[model samples]
Target: MNRTTPSTHPSSDKGHSVVAAPVTAHPLAELIAHEIRERGGWMGFERFMELALYAPGLGYYSGGRRVLGQRPQDGSDFVTAPELTPLFGEVLARQVLQALDATGTDEVWEFGAGTGALAEQLLGELGDRIQRYVIVDLSGSLRDRQHQRLLKAHPSLVHKVIWADSLPEAMSGVIVGNEVLDAMPVHLLSWDGARWQERGVALAPQGDTPHPTFAWADRPAPEGVRPPTEHPDSAYPPGTVTETHGQAEAFVATLAQRMVRGAAFFLDYGFPEAEYHLPQRHGGTLMCHHAHTADADPLAMVGDKDITAHVNFTGIALAGQEAGWEVLGYCSQGRFLTNCGLGEALARTGQASNAADIQSRVALQMLVAEHEMGELFKVIGFVKGPWFEAIGFAHGDRTHTL
Candidate 1:
């Protein structure tokens, strides 16, 4: 694979910027081009995303990239909550402990356990209260990293840690997924004045470039293919682009079916269906992150960056509820963490006079402050057997909104 510095170019189509660079021969690019050709020169964006992120050994997550870190200087793409500070996981552990006790389950299932930082923190805090810690991650490289980190962090309990590529046939545990649903592939739907179309990827015409260049191509959407909006299509102005979370919703439904009795929580940045498909919000939430920078062009850097879309919590709740899982609660991450005792934990850290303490204080603030991750990020919980008031959503439960 050839590596070259990327330069940003303002895109005229949408307000989002794109990484404009010379087309270089990359293995993943070639593979995708071949697939597009085999599929008659057009491939759905969802399939492209699936291959770009989770296709065996060539995808981004599985391609041995250092994806999670505090800074771009570490050759990482983005920073997650657990990576931001240990306080995040510590505060979340309270809810997990409550769920374990409430559900009478000893196992903890974590999806997309990046760097295993949260797992390590949870394992350390929960101690022997956890019988089995199962991690379901598609990235082999990340699994290796998680294994090493967990082994060193919790030597005695490492034996109880299990790594699986997919969910088991039947299981009972408290499931946790941080920034996981947003990564799942989503179908892109663009609205025109007349009708809705499915946005896809197609090979650009041959030019002086050395490798194949991909471009957006739209086709008429199938019948009933439109955003889940209460308002009529005419309400949205032309050029409105959005995503449908089929894969993510299916994931929740499947998990609800598999789990005999347990609770699950997902933390991510998203909004309800009404807010998601708003008229003024023309550009969708589809974004790409690389080296701590964000861009809108997923076609530019095939397997080098992370592609994600905002979660539609309303749809997620319906899916789970339809599949026999009761909605425990839904609220902002800031409120949930605060309700789960984040403020108390901060107090225990003492006055922020020392540099280390100050840094901890800042990280904690970012996790809860409305201007930062607190407001935009949300937490949704689900229970299979019986409904118990989750501590995280005790005070600020927004399940009514969902």
Candidate 2:
């Protein structure tokens, strides 16, 4: 396991910046290009996302680069909860403890333990009381690093740690995946004002070299689309483009099928079914991350960049119900935190710290406020059995909040 940051290999010089690092042919980039060519040069954005996120060894996550690398070029690409504050984990611990006690299990399984920050924080909060802690992720190097970090942070809890390649078979415990589902492959569907078509990527021949371009595939309008765009409301434009997620359904279905007699909590950015289908969001929510900047060009950097789509919470809830799990609760990140006593937590910390700790309070507010990641990100939980009495689900109208 290496802590060194993986290099982003630029695939083409066109549309690249002088500030952009020189092009290096990462194996994943070549494979993606070849795959596109083999597929007659036109593949859906979903296919592109599948390749970017899960394509064997060459994809963003599969290719050994930091998929959570959200920071910037000098460092990694991204910073999540564990990266921002330890309090995030403490609050999560409080929530997880509620779920664990309800489920009557002491197991904790985490997916994509980015930098092991969440794991370290949760373990620190749970202490020796937690019976088992497991991480299901691909980066073996990251798993080793996580092991070392956890051991150093809580040597007493080291014996309880477990690492696996996938979710345990019919395990009874609390499962936590933060900012995970957004990375799942998303099929981009657009209403051309006449018919529904899926956005596909293809190889565009540029002299001796090739570049990727967006093309359309004939498909039915996603289930959420409305035939007549007649909004008797404000802020919505007629003839606007809209996007809905089909991939999120598949992922949630998979989770629902596997999760039996336990609780599953997923935290990501998205809206409810009604809000998700609003006419204002016509441009679609598909975006790519290149050198920390958001770009629409999925083919710009190949495997070196991050491509993500917003999760559809409505779809997740529907899929979870279909998969035989009970939808325990749903809420915006703000309401979920508030229901989880975020305000009280902040007040308690405020009482403990001096003026210097003001920044921490501000940051906490940012996480749960209406304007920040609070509204954009949401928390949804599914329980297989009688795991009730949690803060977020029992009290808040997550639907109205959205």
Candidate 3:
């Protein structure tokens, strides 16, 4: 959502910061604090993040907040490609069509279908070709919003859409997950040249305020635990902070395992392993977003903001490969979208000076510009059945990079 990379700074008490001392207790803060106490005043950053983003009825996504939109004026936290323009899905649908035909499947599964904007675009473009459109999302509130949007937009085709609470034992479809992996909980790790530690969350002592303030707390990581990097500990400068995407990797492995026949395409902003863990990237990619603005402090606003980390494409590819899936390709979003005809679609808008056409053109540029989402956002495709040359990766395929 919010695409800002903020550096982590050292604090007085070890490397942790006393993030905030709230004037009043946030309900979610209290809940997390109680859990910290229950767990002996410490909680792994992964669990803390899971609670902060997905705890039932209190976390960010499950808290009934309007998260995705074009701007802050709509009371939305951040914007996604689908929200930026319908052309994203329209172009992606071309790739999905190829995957569906190659795998001989008529179903489509979308994880974390934010606002259902992409779903609407795909469903409209693909039409009767798709027998079913299954959405697997954790946010009940967002699911309700998606239902209403889809119903109003495609009244006759609404019945083809289904909401699934969880993945079944077996499924066949072209799966899509846009901006999903980055949101999964990641384990925070900090290296101090000599040793590495697992950074977690601890409640700061309660002062005059009734609520608890959160702070960073580092404990010796398990003997073998470390960042998935080829570099040695000596290569990392002291106080270098980073993240390991166990959950995200496992999620991909699970998807690879469950799909009987189909392909999956995930689009997100991230780097390959080598770039992700470069010595200069010591600050790590963990970030928080609220009202379309971004910050590095996730412990401050609690459930009021969205927390995320950059996806490790190398790790994702390995996970899927190890779990019986073949990598179709990986490349920049710009290249993939262009291969799928995004540039051609933009050209169709012509020289019309209408506001809608102008806006569409601008959005298309943002999607493919190197300084914008084009270079930063990447698409990775996986297939469980026979591999075919996907149109999205017809050119500039970077599968070897991963």
Compare the candidates by lDDT and give the number of the best one. 3
The residue-by-residue lDDT of candidate 2 on 12-88, one tens digit each, is: 11121122212435666567667777887656667777886778767777666654543565445655655665667
Clashes found in each candidate (C-alpha, N, C closer than 3 A): 0, 8, 0
For residues 27-127, write the lDDT of model 1, one tens digit per residue.
Answer: 89899989999999889989999999987778899888998887889898888888777888999999999999999999999999999999999999999
Which has the higher TM-score value, candidate number 1 or candidate number 2?
Answer: 1
| Pairs with backbone N, CA or C atoms under 3 Å apart (clashes), candidate 1 | none
TM-score of each: 0.94, 0.83, 0.97
Off by over 4 Å in 3: 1-24
With a 3 Å backbone cut-off (N, CA, C), the pairs that clash in candidate 2 are 41-202, 69-77, 69-78, 70-77, 70-78, 71-77, 71-78, 241-282
lDDT of 3 by residue, 56-119 (tens): 9999999999988878898998888887778888999999999999999999999999999999
> Alpha carbon lDDT of residue 13, candidate 3?
33
* Model 1 regions more than 4 Å off: 1-22
lDDT of 2 at 253: 81
Output the TM-score of candidate 2: 0.83
